[model samples]
Target chain A: MDATTVTTWMREIETSVTQERDRLVQLDAAIGDGDHGTNMTRGFAAVVQALSQDQEAPPGRLLILAGRTLVSSVGGASGPLWGSALRSGGRVLGDQATFDGPQLVEVLAAALASVKDLGAASVGDKTMVDALEPAVAALGRTVGEGASLADALEAAAAAAEAGMRSTIPLQARKGRASYLGERSIGHQDPGATSTALMIRALQRAAAASS
Target chain B: MAIQTKPRKFLNDPADVVKESLAGLAAAHGDLLRYDRAAQIIVCKDAPRAGKVALVSGGGSGHEPLHGGFVGRGMLDAACPGEVFTSPVPDQMLAATKAVDGGAGVVHIVKNYTGDVLNFKMAAEDAADDGIRVASVVIDDDVAVQDSLYTAGRRGVGATVLAEKIAGAAAEKGASLDKVADTVKRVNERARSFGVALSSCVPPASGKPIFELPEGEIELGIGIHGEPGRRRAALGSASEVVDVMVEAVISDLKARAGSQVLAFVNGMGGTPQLELYLLYGEVDRKLRAAGVVPVRNLVGSYITSLEMAGASLTVLQLDDELTELWDAPVHTPALRWGV
Candidate 1:
């Protein structure tokens, strides 16, 4: 992806987060603090503003700036988790002006690992990892099979949706939802849902580029 | 709006709750505190008092009389309240730290929630980049859960109030930032807290209860944000609840029969002072019976959840130094003594 394309994807994610803010907040209200939606909205809004100011920067630097903005602007667990993920992914992307399917897969994989490390969560922890890990795996598989970037992203988004759904029955093992213990079983994990939304936004941006 | 059956709270807009509340606070206590509208920080009017280390503390909005209300002569030099249950962003902390640095440095008394810890870490770094010295102490004295939603260890609850009071007094005494931080750390290490929630509380933005507890059900070991507790049990008598909470704290602290402590009984927002006093009586009796002498005590609502109906017990094993600091004069919006 080029710088412009990365910027487009961020804007898409911002729009998606804005549109789905209340839903995400409602989900959090059930099992965690009800500020996830507001926090995500604030973080992404800051990212968009930062991106707009430094539009000439390369994709890697732009993503890094976005991550830093998120970390500074958003509070609560999601801030550090999402911020570190984007920062690590951006660092791996380095100063590359453009990237391809394989490059994007690597970026996602690195981001997923960063989140898992920061949150200390695993696949069954009912966190954003539930959505992000599956999506990364699907993207890696499709990209390794030499699929088009668009196709890989589409597959990744679908896998993320499924992963998010899977969190509904999970006993949370991390994040604020974990405090609910057995009570967390029925409520959907808000972090997973928001991660799915982010992946879907990436797919939409890729399709538009294609 | 479907006939507007939502729970009514004394709020203008959900988003403006913190700002409005801080505005009212500053207005009411203009002589003692100054609220920075843009930065969302409440600072003591006499901030940057020459050659004195400053104490700063804050976290989410619902816990009133905490960081903000305690901003005065002997408590926090500055307070940074965020949106409910959310940590204040770095900008607020950096600005407040810079504004309140009295040439000695600043000490940040942070709660142990993930957000507060991360945000404070960033803020400390940012302030340090500007050559402002910053020291920090993280309070995690609630012995309820080992690891919960966003905490690595015990949640910081009642002990936070003790930390602010004792450490604030240390700063007031012209102690260095490191000394203040060290004193606060000692207070945290020697303190333990336990809480029980009678009912769930709704944030203004959410407009719905956070959790459901059947009538006569109580959640033991509740965090300050109304986060789910360790376990749910049928509502017992006031004495029974107090006994359980006091016992948990005393056990966690490993207090001997002759241990001298400062016992604090704190009310969650919706709980009345009368009920808190009733509970305090039980706590006093229980501590005395256990051979722990209540050398000093505090009772009332200082740190609180948003209208959460419950109480928390905090026991600080005291030493001469801590006792002297605790006895020092304090003048704040919520807490006052020895005028």
Candidate 2:
């Protein structure tokens, strides 16, 4: 993957976040505060601004900038979690001028670990982790099997979507849904949906790059 | 009809009231608060100390001292204030995370509102992309909307304070982000809250009440946004109101035969403490009769519904850990202890 590929992914993430904004907020309304759509829109809009202005920055640096912008802009729990994921992923990428499938997997793994450390949400918490963990694992497995970058990302995106759907039956163990006790089950986890969007953005970006 | 003069005088424009109020609040509480005017963020002036995981939270305007006033040594690391009753746009939340993130990572304590949850989720994604480890705990202790179809879900109410106090102490003791998150989840599980609004709030800018109610009637399960409640009922005595509210909270707690609990009697914005304590008196008695021991108690306005006249009751089953944290020193302007 090259800088252009990363840029394409960033653009995809922005678009996906925008497209899914209302849906995510609607899900959140089921078990959370009702500002997910507005919040995501504001954060992604900022990311787009940052990416568009600093075209010469390396992919990693651009991601780091985006992460910092998010941390400084978005409010609420997700801000720090997503910001850390990007920052951690960017750190892992370092100054590498380009990253192949294996390198992407490593960065993703590191990003996932960083998110886990920050959110403390495990696999079954009915949180973003539900989607993110599965997607990252799928990406790693596909890359390990020597699939092309686009194919690995596609697999990850599919896994993430499945994971997001799986959250519908989960009794939330993290975030606001946990407050509902057993009632939290039966509704889709908003965070998981957003996580799926993030992974799908990666897949779309990779396909575009190819 | 005669036009009435506005009573508020501290603002430049009606639109600027929330921001100006926050500015004044920060100045008065400067020792404990560091306000980011541009970002509309507030942080505990001292943060990121080794061995302490930061606790952060936030929401819209009107709930002053809520996400903001709670910022102190034992409460919150940061708070992002949003527009009136609207969730803080994500930009503020993102800024708060960066300010409070101390290498050990930060835990965002959120209310269970759709807007608040979504914004926080997006911010988490952004944070993930960055390197700051972030965790979130969504508080949904309110039990009023157990069966509502018109609303998003159950609203977060009184239990927010209990969650913040408990989680803040846990983080202060150097609990890992996971431990803090779990502790928050545990409290949410054991706690339940219910509230009734006696009146509706008038937005600072609009200067008109969001909804109108008959003088002799009260909205039974009124949410903070002046949303309709579970049902309307005649305005009753303090004891009578407390009975209904406490009953709702107790039933929702699902406490076993002999569980001990911490009770918080919170005042909505326009309610005075005198009235709150009167209601608390009834609540304390009813709780005793219910066979649940009131292990600890808090009575005051920790959370508000703009300027609405009402109160909410929160009951949490307490264990050793929670009790200890509840007893920890907290010095926020709204609630002060230990220090």
Q: Pick the candidate with the highest DockQ.
A: 1
Give per-residue lDDT, candidate 2, residue A132: 91
The pairs that clash in candidate 1 are A175-B149, A176-B149, B257-B291
Candidate 1 residue lDDT tens string, B1-339: 235356678877787988999999999999999999999999999888989999888898899888899999888899999888888887899989998998899999899876788788878998999999999889999888665444356778888888898998998888887899999999999999988999888888768777788998999988888777868999999989988998798888997779889999999998999999999899999999988999999999998999999989999999999999999999999999987
Q: Count clashes in each candidate, considering only residues at least 3 apart in sequence or on different chains.
A: 3, 66
- Candidate 2 segments whose C-alpha is farther than 4 A from its true place: A1-210, B1-10, B147-151
Clashes of 2: 66
Instruction: Provide the TM-score, chain A, model 1.
Output: 0.98
lDDT of 2 by residue, B1-339 (tens): 348568454557875776788888889999988778988888888875665788878887777558788888887888888766666756777788888888888888888775578778877877888888888888877787763433346777777778888898888877998999898899988998888888877665445465577898887765665444656799888888888887888887778877889988888888998998988889899998887889799988778877789888889999998999889888886778788
User: How do the residues A1-210 of candidate 2 rate in per-residue lDDT, one tens digit apiece?
Assistant: 777777787778778878876566557656554445556666778887888888787778877888877765565566667877888888888887887888888778888898788666788888888999999899989889988777788899999999999998987766656645565679898888888988898888878777
Worst 10 residues of 2 chain A by lDDT: A29-38
Tell me, what's the RMSD of every candidate?
Answer: 2.4, 9.1
Which TM-score value belongs to model 2?
0.64
- Candidates in order have lDDT scores of 0.88, 0.78
